[model samples]
Structure formats: structure tokens, C-alpha cells
Target: MFKGLAVLLVFQLTGEIIAFGSHLPIPGPVLGMILLIVCLRFRTSGRLVEDIERTSSGLLSNLGLFFVPAGVGIMAMVQTVQSEGIKIGFILIASTFLTLIVSVWIFIQTRKVVERHRETQ
Candidate 1:
């Protein structure tokens, strides 16, 4: 578990370095996740994968704990949130819808590709 966590942190740090050096707009963690996915896809280490999966499952089981900071942040910025509540709500709703639409579209496209691959096979 520690090893898997360390590996995750290393990837994130590597991504942060690359993003900072390249001045990319993307978040470091996002880049790190993409890099991790690519590495896992090409790598042939079942034990490493198993460790990562176990670690990921453990982390996910406690995922709700991650929201504590966000909740506290909102509470800290209560005045600002009240002042811009309408605008913030609008942006949040719009972004949520946009995300849902994009996710659905990606799912559809992936399904099509999978179906095509299956047909060819």
C-alpha cells in the first residue's frame, strides 16, 4: 500500500514538474493520472497493478473524507459565496450539465469503437 501510494505521488510530482516547466494550463494531478494510465497500459507487472488496485480501492472507500476540505473552504468563504451566490450557482449548474453532456458523448464514442473492434474480431 505504501509502495503504491509512493508511486502515485512520484507520478504526480513528475507531472507537476513537466507542467510547470512547459507552462501547461492543465492540472498536475490530471497529467499525472494520464501518465499513470499510459504506464499501466504498457507495463507487464501484475504485482504492481495488484498493489495499485488495492491501494486505489482503499483510497476510494474513504473518498468522502476528501470532501471535508472543500466543505470547510466553502464555510470559510461564506461571505463571498453569499455575495456571488447566483452567479456561482449558474456557473456550477452550467458546468455540471456541460460535464454530463461531454461524459455521455465520450461514452457513446467509446462504445462505438468497442463495437467496431468486436465486429472486426
Candidate 2:
């Protein structure tokens, strides 16, 4: 498990470095995930894949714990929110809605491209 985790981290770091060096708009971790898929598609390593899956599952299982800090930070900002509550609420709602729209747009675009590729293939 540890070995697989290490390998995943290494590849993630490599992708992140490439993304950084090339000035990619996407985050490094996102690129790393893509790279992981590419690697999986090309390689035939059952044990390694299994290990990676196990490690990923473990990480995901405790994902809520990871958000604790964010929750804490929000709690710590109670006073600020209390002061600018209305404006903050409006801004958060607007930004969240905009993010959702953009994400949906990107998902639709990607789905279209994938469907086209599948049709051609």
C-alpha cells in the first residue's frame, strides 16, 4: 500500500511539475489524475493497481476529516461573517452558482467530445 501510494505521489508530483512548467490552467493534481489514467490504460500491473485502489479507498474514506480545517476556518470567521453577513452571503451564492454553471458547461463539452470520438471509432 505504501509503495503504491509513493508511486502515485511521484507521478502526481511529476504531472504537477509539468503543469507548472508549461503554465497549464488546470491544477497539478487534476493533471496527475489524468496521467494516472493514461498509465493504467497502457500498463498491465494488477497488483500495483489493486494497491493503488486500496490506498485511494483509504484516503477517500477519511476525506471528511480533511475538510475539518475548512470548517474550522469558517467557524473562526464567525465575527467577520456576522459583520458583512449579507454581502458575504450574496457573493458566496453568486460565485457558487457561477462555478456550478462553468463546471456543467465543461462537463457537457467533454461529454460531447467523448461521444464524437466514440462515434468515429
Superposition error at 19 for model 1 (Å): 1.5
Best by lDDT: 1
lDDT (C-alpha) at residue 76 in model 1: 100
Clashing pairs in 2: none
Candidate 1, after superposition: displacement of residue 25 in Å?
A: 1.9
How many pairs collide in each candidate, listed in order?
0, 0
lDDT of 2 by residue, 5-59 (tens): 9978988898899899999898888899899999999886778888888999999
Q: Give the TM-score (vs. native) of candidate 2.
A: 0.71
Pairs that collide in candidate 1 are none
Q: Cα miss at 81, model 2 (Å)?
A: 3.1
TM of each candidate vs. truth: 0.93, 0.71
lDDT of each: 0.94, 0.92
